[model samples]
Target: MNAPRSLDARLTEQRNPRTARIDQLATLEIVDLINAEDRMVAAAVGEERQQIARAIDIVVECLRAGGRLFYVGAGTSGRLGVLDASEMPPTYRTDPALVQGIIAGGLDALVRAQEGAEDHAGDGAAAMDEKNVDARDFVLGIAASGTTPYVHGALQRARERGARTGFLLCSWPSEALMKTHDVVIAPLVGPEVITGSTRMKAGTATKIVLNTISTAAMVKLGKVYGNLMVDLQVTCQKLQDRGERILMATVGVSREEAQRLLDESGGHVKTAIVMASRSLDAQEARQRLDAAGGSVTELVGTLPVA
Candidate 1:
């Protein structure tokens, strides 16, 4: 089978007429060329906003039904997945298992090059099965080239077992690979800053795309409120302070009053908002939040404007 033309790879090719002086160009000229291509990364992602929004909605649905989100990739893509997953626990106070990342060379792949590990497509399939992926789950295989055997094999197995399978590739749509996946998201951010080093521009594009998908989906899942990460953990005093401030500003209560509600709600921003605005106590606040499906917007949405 003919390989798919790398849509990004084609676009990012240095277009200026090659000259004998090309080898003698100054470092700044090379930097300028790279900057030009890097500037297009955001535009590529922006063009796919609607598709990204759809992916977010689907991810939220999976999590709502007690499912997990898994990211499988090799090399830079794998490392990026690991980095994003690692941040979730601290940033959003979510369970570590809720969003997991599997790199080609296991945890070691995050740092050093895992040569040949990506070629083991069977390893990718094994990882998915080990995770016990279910229909309620979403698995996204990210590969800048769009033809990573490791990711393709995982997508194939993920589909066969009934999990919603998605692919994030930088290549033009290749039917051979696309047919194996359910959702195909190709944000063709053309090429790398350094020839084949996808870690540069391609990786940046993938990271931005992943961040958007997960964050937007979280918002849909009621994890965010008025641009605030309401689900942020109050385990730290700083977060607890932030929770108090959010409650006071959102509920229009005094600083002291918001702190009181925060203490009553055990530092829960959602509960504190409900308790302060609705004049309900802790238990009632929880009941109200639960009824609102954990959304502060919905609960306060019904109250008269202060």
Candidate 2:
């Protein structure tokens, strides 16, 4: 016979004393109570700054080595992971294969909740196998409650396949969990306003953490120059307009000249900047950028402060 799982030990599963009387409060009071609880979330995330920075370094290392990054989770965690991965291509001009998200119930679960999908550990391991995760790759598992069998299973297999792994949870992390992976990010956001409703505070913390990791990695990889996304490629009207504006501001060109440069550079913002700043043609600008390792700063100095 097996012992029963103790849900009480999980910080995310515990009832909050602060919101104990939330049900009896008026609508405005209820809103205030929830707001108060939400305020603590940022501080909790801040407490894990060092751990988050470490995770970013690992991700940068993996990407620089031509390895991919995978975010594995289930439920809200899975959805958040997928959301972060999907934004990389358009935001950073990265290949979609560079960052991936694996949910226990797969893509279908992304639109609709799939009950019991997180219970099967074997499925998680299979997902890692299907992705062909290797030593050069980095896999980060997200589980708010810190006990999701599926996430653990996937990370375990990822490690077995020689991939570096990390874990992100909203509750308190055990010592074993800290030592098991290269990094463990646990933002103790306390219990939710509705008691065990981790989708509130925990979800917010997870989103913030993912944003920091991916954005920092992109900036380090020269996808961003100063505060501008230099790697941007004009894919839509909005992006085309934005790219032209970027060139106008950075290269000291008029709108017409910016548009011409953009067209000449095939709508590549960084290449256009290189062409305009270095007084080079498109081909020469591309060669210079390639030689400088795609760093606009390496070709042209840093953007002047406004």
Candidate 2 pairs with clashing backbones: none
Q: Report the lDDT tens digits of candidate 1 across residue range 1-306.
A: 543444444433422232223457798987776677788889988887877777787888899999999999999999888888887876666799999988988998887899689998898898888888878899999988776889878877887778998888776867766676667778777645545667877788899999998888777777777787777767887887788777766877888887777778887777777777788899998898878888887877743444
TM-score of 2: 0.96
Count of backbone clashes, every candidate in sequence: 1, 0
Tens-place lDDT digits, model 2, residues 158-212: 9999999999999889999988999999999988887778889999999999999
- TM-score for all models, in order of appearance: 0.87, 0.96
**CA lDDT, candidate 1, residue 113:** 93
lDDT of each: 0.79, 0.92
Cα lDDT, model 1, residue 66 = 93
RMSD of each: 4.4, 3.5
Tell me how many residue pairs clash in candidate 2: 0
